[model samples]
Target: MSKKNRKFLATTVTAAAVAAVLAPSVSADELKFTDVSDTYADAVNFLVGNGITKGVEDTKFGTHQNITRVDAAVLVARALGFDENGKYKDAGFTDVPDRAKWAVNALVQNNVVDGLSTTKFGSYDNLTRGQTAKLLANAAKLPVNDGVTKTKFTDVNENFAKYVDALVREGVTKGKEETKFGANDAVKRGELALFLDRAKEHFGFFDLFVMHTNDTHAKADMGPKRATAVKELRSEHKNNLLVDAGDVFSGTLYFNEFQGAADLQMMNYMGYDAMTFGNHEFDLGSSEEGHKALASFVKNAKFPMLSANLDFSKDELFIGLQNNRYTSDYSNGIYDGIVVDVNGEEVGIFGLTTEETPTISSTGEVQFANYVEKAKEAVAAFEARGVDKIIALTHLGYNDSLNFDNDLELAKKVEGIDIIVGGHTHSELKDPVVSNEFDAPTIIVQAGTQSKYLGTLNAVFNEDGVVTSFGGELVKVGDFEADAKAEEILAPYKKKVDELMNQSTGVSTEVALDGGRDSNNEGNSSVRHNETNLGNLITDGMLATAKTINDKTTIAMQNGGGIRASIDEGDITVGEVMTVLPFGNALAIMELKGSEIKAALEHSVSADLRDDKTGLKESGAFLHVSGLKFEYDSSKPAGERVTKVEVSEGDKFVALDDAKTYFVATNTFTAAGGDGYDMFGKAYADGRVSEPGNVDYQMFIDYLNVLDKVAPAVEGRIVDVNPAAAKTVAE
Candidate 1:
């Protein structure tokens, strides 16, 4: 009844085959229709498989048998869900040769059939094409144009003209030939099966099958598993789409060496229908080439990448390859959105990225518009195209902060979106979540990170273009075997990666670097809660790197979660440093007030828990400092935890002044509020941050080269007054 729901429900009818495709498939082998050829067998299988008809015999379907008027009534009744329970007078039934008496009665009771005379039901005569049209039109309750005396069909008389016009208007048939109806000709059994099937789609039922993934951050090794799953699932659904939400770049050595080429190959081979650009997709936008790698990835992708709110026109690398509006005719290019026709259903798809892209990633000149405004415009454009079922492939986090642009807020603000396949936060939505934000429901789904799972969603939409029934699940990639063809394609890339990981970085350590999770012989994760020598060494490297670009940058920090693995006391390989900082996070230098620094350090251990079994539980937010020393009282409350904070002035440590402003360096992830560092994000948004575009591992490697032999120690920079959660003085 609402304007949004009515835009897509008007003026269109699909063939009855839409019904068969939506329901479970029935093999042609199950039916004994030997006379039906492979080309025409689908319709016959649909009829017999759905209990709408039985063959003339057990081994044969009598494919070409003449369908009498009474037989037409029987088939139409079954297709309309009318059981033969109606009792009738001599008006239209009870005299049609017991085989079709009840069938004729049901049709007559429904006002879909009429007798030639009071005592006659036209039982023995072969049904005419014109009569078939009238029966189908009446049975399916199609709107008849009573004044339509003239139609495309020249042979149709005034009596059958309205009924034939109704069928044509609903897209039931084009006539026997395009211009001729052959109104008086006898209908064959096969022909009737096709007609009835075509008429069934007018009942206003639609089904959509979706296969989606998100936050697959360069986990290229799982390409084979994904390929196998995508291929199998694509074949299983008739009306389907294969889509990804975003974040397909960064995270592993595959991206480090290949620069999204390897991931693009796998995506193209696996057949992605559409994709959206995640923020990390533009990670190299600040490099010398300025988005050259991202441009190549876009140029080579076999599928269209949708981006409704982002603009790349200013960048020469994306010239002629990107468009600014929504379209129905989509190919391999970037557009605001695209219209996909799935089994005669018009599904409008668009993409939305977080507005925080500029502050977060190395987006360079590529501008990001407000997500909510663009999303509304996209839905309006889709509505103008008469497409009701809309899908938004998004990189906006699923449940990010309400103040930020997230999928929940988008769904709540937008009026007509039916499905939202999202990413960015990397949430593994085991089940679909619905937002009843408007008159219609919007179903949101996200596949977990690293290509570990594939999301499958099956939904049933009503004539109003609203989802009435839905189900979704995450399929574990590890459960399936690797596809052979994909493995063959991946072999060369894997070899190159193995060789790169094994290549030495020309730097060695005297003792173990102690990047391990546990610092003491206790359960506390050393890298996260208690500082280690490796943390100190890594931060020292960041500070050294940042100062080379901006001498004002005096302090450097690293999030505990960013340090993944430790190194042994030996020659460090390129792979060893890469393993430690696998995210490919770039260096970000931010100018912050000393008070803001204290707030950030406090939030670092705000959630630290001391469990009886795990000893002290620290979150990934714990910070490893480089040019400063901070002390916290773990026994005190969170906001009041930090006891004292000071900055190192060459050889002397001076107490940090509350009003002083200082420059600090950290990874791009943390500078953008990653791991709950909102203070850094606030500063970055205020334009106090500068990204030198130096990759984190490359900086570490550079620092390692300068040091030659690493021997760094945690010299009481971060201390805890409460001895219970503190590491021993020697440690």
Candidate 2:
């Protein structure tokens, strides 16, 4: 990734603090297991009434006692129901002193313990404040300290650093002073009562908060400040949502560990509502196995895996991937959309992957269809079921030129879709890019790549199901304090990823990437418009990697959108590279007649369907490419916009003939004529490639990191062919 990109990703670290107090309730209900004479009656009653803690004996309420480490574990495990699994039956520990045997087995079986020095359980050891905080926070599944970033405790140094800060954030623990954690202090039974009480308050309420982390690319651990940031969001938002926008497969060596199983588990613990699959979801190298692993990972999903475009009717992998494994359980997608009653309002969500599956997905036996067609069908289905307040989860990128009117067009054409919470392109829309698709307007958003930013949207819907007013922003992952609960959930993965991301790659001259549009005199900027050494390096890598299969390959064309990220000028790591190129999109070379190529060129120049409603600069796929050069005048009418065209051979521009056939390399999206490149569609209605992976964003970073300095300047690769003097070319 570029230094600017890394800096951009790192900019989210500003932490904010909020005060959270345990709200009280009035109830005189008798405690079933406790007598009125119990010394801990008030504390126990308060906890039991709020559903926080329960009694262990018929008449004895252990209140003033210093709870044993074993006792604390049991209370926490039972409260969270962590001991129900049969997987911990063989759990063995040497230091539990038999008296704490049940607690040791329960904690160990639930993955709540880091091995206590090999075979020892350390049960006889007094639980320090730090240890107690960690255990209670994890058991309650609450944010470490309600997402507070850092505290000012004088005594809490880095040694007890792990729990003091996190526990305080989650409201589970507050150390002795501004500078002291009192790490050796024992947590009394009454103190535990307070922690459990707060957890119960947050859990029992219906207030909902939704969080999402899309296109993970197998990084598994939080990227930069993401883990900390999302955790904070959950704690701050109170009711929360954490989601992945698919593409969780492939990318790093972590996937090699259980084939992306651990990543799914991490996401589950982080609490995802629903995740939409990206093309990379097929990268187990086996569609069936990949599907099975996906199912297995979500075996204990608190949410569902929603995908409406690709029909899994014949796929063995989706045997029972729906909600609750019920035959008619369309609870999430009764109308091709899930209705979530968040804070009392209903939120309708639908999901669709880019229809470019034959080229991008390794479905083995799975078949895919056109996203536009499926989206139309799905939306129609939702409409039929009275779900008008719709949000589409799309994996399609935003292209300025090839405007066959996909998502952007859908934003305008479709009527019910209020927001398009999009993934795939990794384009960061800091503000909602309002789509004039309907009278109500569609709010579209994307949070670049990785877990760098949390996209937030607030829509005010009237009783009519139309968006009355809507606004959204991308919150940098570093801006909020890490949510303690999220931290505890991700702690294991974070450590593992730290070991993986810390290794360096190389450095560069300057920040070398600009992902959006280029506004310079050439219609593209040096940093943004033309392919940088980074884009060239990536495209070149694809060509080099693919040539191992086809020596006959001449020129390769990688869609700009598919080039996910740039290699920043700095130390690079394998994980950073994968983040850029997360998908397994491979290279494909197709045979096209020169006439078909001319048609493709024409489609690109005029692809920007500019009308008064949508300004000239608003065409979705207006950007062109490498290997070819083109010029156009928007002043000219549509179909007559281009004035000249040329292809480069070595360093010289060559005139082209429309009758000859040539080999071209590109991805399945453009090849399928997705952006109104009908000539390509007509020529290769059956066009295809056999490669299973694309270098994606990370490959470009890897390529750049290998080269200490990069020079990414745009060369006039694609030129225009004018209509006024085109007699030299055939009609």
lDDT of 2 by residue, 198-308 (tens): 453332322233455566666565443565666566667654455556677765656645566656666655556677777777655364355676556545555666666
Model 2 worst lDDT window (10 residues): 1-10
Candidate of highest TM-score: 1
Q: Which 10 residues in a row give candidate 1 its minimum summed lDDT? A: 8-17
Clashes of 2: 77
TM-score of 1: 0.64
Model 2 TM-score (2 dp): 0.47
Residue-by-residue lDDT tens digits, candidate 1, 1-731? 23443322110112231222112212343334578886556556556634578778866777788998988788887767565665654343445877777778777877988888777787888999999889889888999988899788899999999999988887667787878999999999888887875665554546688999987878899999999998888887777899989888876778888999999999999988999998788777777887998899889999999999988988888899998888877688899999998888899999988776676568887888889999989999988888888999999876554445788778888888889999976667887776654656677899877788999987656666776546678999888899999999999999998998899988898878876776453554478787889899989999998887678787999998899888899899988898888777767788899999999999887865575422236678989999998998877777898999999787988999879989999987898788989998788556576654466887888798988468887788888777765444435
For every model shown, the clashing-pair count is 2, 77
Off by over 4 Å in 1: 1-203, 401-404, 506-511, 517-529, 539-565, 578-623, 626-628, 632-709, 720-731
Off by over 4 Å in 2: 1-212, 234-242, 256-258, 285-290, 323-336, 380-386, 400-405, 479-540, 544-553, 556-693, 696-731
